[model samples]
Target: MPRAVNARATVTLLAVCWCVVPPRLAGDFNPYGINSAYWNSPSVNAAYRAMGVGTARVLLDWALAEPADGGYDWSAWDTALVHCSSHGFAVSLAVCGVPAWAIRVPGRELSYAPEAFAEFVCAALNRARTLAPGIVQSFEWHEEPTHAWADGIPPLHGTEQRDPSQYFVAILTTTYRAVKQAFPEVTVVMDGIRGAFHHVDDLYQLGCGPYFDAINIHQYQPHAPGCDDPSGMHLFHFPTLLTYLRFMANRWGDDKPVWVTQYSWTTSGWGWGDIGEDRKAAYMEYVTDVSRRLGFVHRVFPELGVSSSTAGAGSAAVVYDDGNYVPGPASLSVVTTAYLRLKVCAQAYPVWTGIPEPVPLLPAASRACAVVNGGFESGAAGWSGAFSVDASTRFTGAFSARVEGDGGYVESARFAVEGGRLYEVKARVKVDAPAPSSAAVWMELFYSSAPGHLGYVMPENYYGVVDTRQYPGGWRRVCWPYFSAPGAYEAFLKFSLQGEGTFRLDDVTVRP
Candidate 1:
């Protein structure tokens, strides 16, 4: 049975709203959060309150908490939870780092005994119920599992104790079942994946979707400018990060909400990719905005709130580790300023480049709206594809268009446009399958001066692969913006079915 909604918790959350968030934006949307690696630290309530953050993530290491088989130490965790609860911060406990004794092999802590791991989860959650009660809302299984860890620990075992995805499946499924059985209302988040997309893909293939409520991802983009690195291993920008998360969701055929558990810019000698102080502040501002705008993501934890001397130069702390707790360049204003700029740019080009809402180069007195038959009420009058009007499912209005083919596309009629103008295309989409099981549903914008042009002729960059799979069973709103070349005058939109799946699209809008 699901736990009853805690009235007191809701009241507390509302009170927090009054303290931090603006009156207009103070509703259910609260994405600003923090994740700390340190076991015990000074109070972060001041920082959290100042930034309008209501969520706090703390690492709960199994090794530190339990040294013996059933012996438990809840001292530090209890303090952490109480501290957060007192500050009106909802807590997300990340359960990671296997107890040394639980390890079957000396180095393979990640692939610890499943029975022991499951037992530990049940014990820990039970203790949390008594100690923190309603304050502990979410539980993440582990940290980054795919990439090599400090002790050569990967998702799988170092020895023959486990094979491929089997070991990981056992660990995740066991913990998830235990957690749900104990506290059904508590959201279960999967172990965050580092840049190891392949390992995550493998885990999904091994059938790990039904176990968790949300997907956790850790994005540490390269220190390089523009969020890209020549090695192609970098996720340098929020858009690229979103794209990767969506693609992974498409492959799983699951629309779980994504949680960026850790993201930040490290200064020179600050551990990972290095950037300057100004860039760090800018990235912090940009990331906060992206978290709010991206509807699918539930929360974004920006590295840490307080710095630690232990982290040395690689620390991505918004507050200096000095006893005085001085605020660094990456603080609340980085978040507030980003939100302000978003409001300012809502109607304008260079319009927040990631989403489909048209941002214009210059603010026009009157914006132009395109798309002849967006609602599909006209019954395929403006669309061409191996498709038909789908009245069964509609995001809005009375109808939506359905495409059931394998390789062809359902395209919109050409809309007249001026050359050298920027435009945005947005649509509400849903799927019969959780995601495209084989291939992906992709979108492209085509421009041509000639009429009746059937073949796609626009530059390859004009196409964007839609990752509808990341949406967790709802009408996902997708938006993409593009700049028309100096010589192009006409443009149309196309929704291509690259894989075998049924898709429903409605309320298509092309704005310029």
Candidate 2:
């Protein structure tokens, strides 16, 4: 499942919001922050600071802190907060969950109040302030109040599945009053909403405008209009975003300083959202530029500085593993104990080109993968030629494609790929045919020019056919590595059966 629920990826066109706060991110030229639950690790916090992460988010769980009504435990919160504060990072705090004693929805962040939540926030902060003297905290009533477990992390107790507008507003209002009463200087942010376009209007209608000191955005780039690079979706997304931002100013009276609490691509790579590591780092670099370019986005938190199965998000962490601060794919290299590293530490980009630098004049980060229904779970909907989605046989997923006879074949949708890069197609194929049975993977490359002629493959691959007969006990693991010589713009992945009996293909993947 998608970790962070988000609006559909449309062409993005972001302009400066006039009422935005003057950004103070020019000092180190790094306007990035780290959000994760593993801040208890000193090495992880150290690595974050070295990587120029100057802001941190704390998802304070009320249930964990005060398991009993009046009893408070400060171990976890203290470690997370003190780690950031001691490292000189500004902390954005959002209390999460209600203890079991309080009525709460099962596993969902929901509606419950006796003004007790407000009081607990103040008490916790008061103690937190003293624990980490001079600790700076910007408070939000709850973490991701707009969505129930949208971050893919569920609460111990809480959600308002119904029209949550009035209930959310009520809680925010009470929490805002209590927090301000305790620490008047702390900024209270509103709606770093996920799927923000859908929920922003409701929050505004419920009179939530006056309770917030700033606005937070948790928008992530989608895979539809684009995810390979930044430029693809900006076209369709601009109107909606600019209009809503304008809508905020017109309806809510004045604009508030905006902070992108979350912006990142998960490296899970299981479904559509997970991106590759190298490209993921490129996205980090790209978003940093976007943050600097947009006047309203004061800081962009790259998210999950470190993650593990126990706490924080495992897929998107820049550093991961249990008990160890392991550098993730975003790092230049996994330089454990040798030195701290990050994407910014790699192949020299203009050092002055991030944070304070203007938006990059380059295309944004996106994926080039274009295989559709490769798993045949969609019943070969996007594939052509003679094939049937077999229900009985499978490798990992539900169904597999079956091709019979010499004329039978299964081909994928025509998708684009860049030239000069090595590409590979992999699949699990099972042959139940006689001795003469054979299967081949065919390749075809296209140029998107006016005449759009087929590009030539290397001499040996001219025919675009590679015969294979290696079938293991159950299924044969087939892999064909191909390359787009030059001027190749698009291509197709096809598998053909040459003999009598039927062959089953499943879990096909094209890697670029």
Candidate 3:
């Protein structure tokens, strides 16, 4: 990505959306974190608290952690972790970077033993125990292994080279073995990849699924004010990352939550100069709300840090220079205005968008359909996933469940399954906005007696995206009639509304 020099871009495009209310989104504010070189001190951390952010991504800088020639020195990290903990912040540590003792070539990772690296990682978490016990939330593998400088996995260096995928899994496998043995619950993240397309495919194919709890992507979008349409063509758009990452996760059955460990609309001297200070701020607010609705993006961190000697970070720094602690405006500068705007959004974000996992919202239905409160007249009593009960919208009753932004596979209560029995699943769906992906009505099978969920069957008419135009009434009936459930067990209905759109479903019925 080249630097956009002398561009001095204008900002009116994104400013229009400044007043739009955040809709009833599919997900809520996940733990917002930041990777910053400057916000390392206790005083600066108050800035994070002002943003209502409670997590900070701290790189367990190896050189900073270990002393010269002997044992570990925990003080460098202690300063940051202790203050963060005091502010009720959880520290997520990333293990990457070079130590001064290394004799290897620069830009490439030092060829160190995996066990040694794992040991170092464990040591960091253990130290955090004393400063802020159990405050460490996740252990990240090489921050961005796709690149040379960002990679922590040691390069083969003159030896017979390993396949890049093999190298990635090897590091993950080694780290997983040691990290889990130490702290089983702490999420171990994959090497935060820079360019994901071909690289992510190799990781899954090489059986790297079981190693990490979350997938990490370092999203460096080439431009800014381009986040509204996550479906937009420009690839590195952060929300676009959410869309592709979800597909890959489902495709390989590696449905782990995605954390964008690093992202920024580069105001650096790089070609990204198309982004102005105000535009950068607007883009941050845009991606934060829009990406959360995708249902899979659990955490997003706007990266902070670039050498002062190098190209300037422009306005990407939410807080920079000093350790000043102010969430509100003392004086109205461009940076402070942006910070205050973001703070409002953060404060307004409703619930914790729990990591997208199968929620068993099981309570038998009032009727034979086995869907409890299917019309949502009784409100959000039985349904699980993101949606709200709106009295204004209904198919048959006084209310319907309103879902927005790629409503991830909303599931119903379990219904009894009989062998060779065909069932009909029907629901009235209303799409208020355009959605390009197919809406699926499917079943998830599970045995009440023995083994659990046996995966979802293919959608009845999954290939084509739902067309709301043909149905003039606005509310269209979607049906999968005569769909059979083979073998013995119980089943549940799931409606997956894909793509970025506002939709509602009510009057759901199931018949055998």
Candidate 4:
């Protein structure tokens, strides 16, 4: 289940928005603001000021806001808002933690009773408007809704299959109506959902697209293979998220601005030990470069128990231990060394290099397979192969091959196609019997869709320890589903055997 907003923090967000945006846009590029949370002391504020951060986001628990079913408290929030306004620090409020009274139900799902939830949203927004006047601009209703109850944290209300879109539409529609009635100039930003791509389409389908001004996303797994690391937070991740976002944008056609609400690179120590000062500096620099180049509204580095020796490299502003904000060292460096690169792009840019065309498997013919070794061998078949294709080639079809000989064995093999500089690889294998009961076969594929690119390998035959008694024969055909690509691509097959067995390979094809 989701929670409501804290009035004071809401006002702070509006103030920050007004402070950050210039009166006019400059060539599609604009600086919003830098923000941090958990900075309670003067030192933290000083660090944030040094880094040039203009706003700060703070957490406000619902339990504290409304202790009883109908009793409401606004004392702490009133003081916090006054302190922030007097000091010129704009605020972004994060509302979370369901109240005990709200969870009296038996199941995990909380029943809001439509009218009751609507009243709550209206009251919350009205209170916010009264306290902050014109300072509150955005409202992030819940924090990571997807993972809200992942780790055995029972929901305040009973358990039910709660659709996120239902909550968003119900709460946001009511809140937006009330907030706009009170402060029409405010900009309302949605909370960061855990899996944006995975759930965005469903949200759109549920008609939850038109309620907010912009979209918010959080990226924690910066370095997962096949994903992009635009912020350079992770070493191996490629930032594939952008590709999925592009796909969704095309589908929705909403043209909503994107904001990265939370992003940070975790070290091996997980905040318990030192993570080399130089590495920390480099990571920060990388994040700044990626954020500016990619046109994200704001990139926040949450200070959740982190101690960096090189604290000022990548951020436009820093959030320090004492709560004093300041401009970071790299902000100055960016102005001097890469200011021109800060210009926003006119159109979307390709994050990864395109792949080349795939070569034909046969010699200008239709189908063929090449053999590597002969006779009953143990570990003698390990070789690399490839096929070429034209640029921007799209292929979808199946390829088959087999190896036959007296006591012959394949160590490992794969199928693939190459293009200008990219290669796509898929693993391949051959079995003598339909269900091999004795040993397991390992196979792989390799190919590039473009020139000057290393080929990617994909596993074909699923490997596991199994009984070989089910399969005992010769020359069995294994056909796979159609593998397709936008650019040039090819097919590859590789295999290895544990026991002595002869094999013959053949029948490879690619279709549109």
**Per-prediction tally of clashes:** 13, 22, 5, 133
Write the residue-wise lDDT of candidate 3 on 144-231 in tens digits: 5554332442222211112233144555788799989988879787777765333454455556667777778776654335432333
What TM-score does model 4 achieve against the real structure?
A: 0.51
Give the TM-score comparing model 2 with the true structure, all chains together.
0.55
Candidate lDDT (C-alpha), each: 0.58, 0.56, 0.56, 0.39
lDDT of 3: 0.56
Tens digits of per-residue lDDT for model 2 on 97-169?
Answer: 7788765633444546738788788887888788875575577666555554333422211222312342566
Tell me how far the alpha carbon of residue 50 in candidate 2 is from the true structure, in angstroms, after superposition: 1.5
Sort order, lDDT high to low: 1, 3, 2, 4
Model 1 lDDT at residue 367: 47
lDDT of 2: 0.56
Please tell me which predicted candidate would have the highest lDDT against the true structure: 1
Model 1 misplaced stretches (Cα beyond 4 Å)? 1-27, 37-43, 149-164, 223-236, 270-274, 308-314, 323-512
Q: Where's the lowest-lDDT run of ten residues in candidate 3?
A: 11-20
- Which digits, one per residue and each the tens of the lDDT, describe model 1 over residues 196-310? 4434444554457687777677877644444422113222335444434544554345555678888766655633345555556566666555554544566778776665433
Model 4 misplaced stretches (Cα beyond 4 Å): 1-40, 104-128, 150-166, 222-239, 271-274, 296-512
Ten-residue stretch with the least lDDT total in model 2: 459-468
lDDT of each residue in 148-195, candidate 4, tens digit only = 222352221111122343244566666666656765665566667544
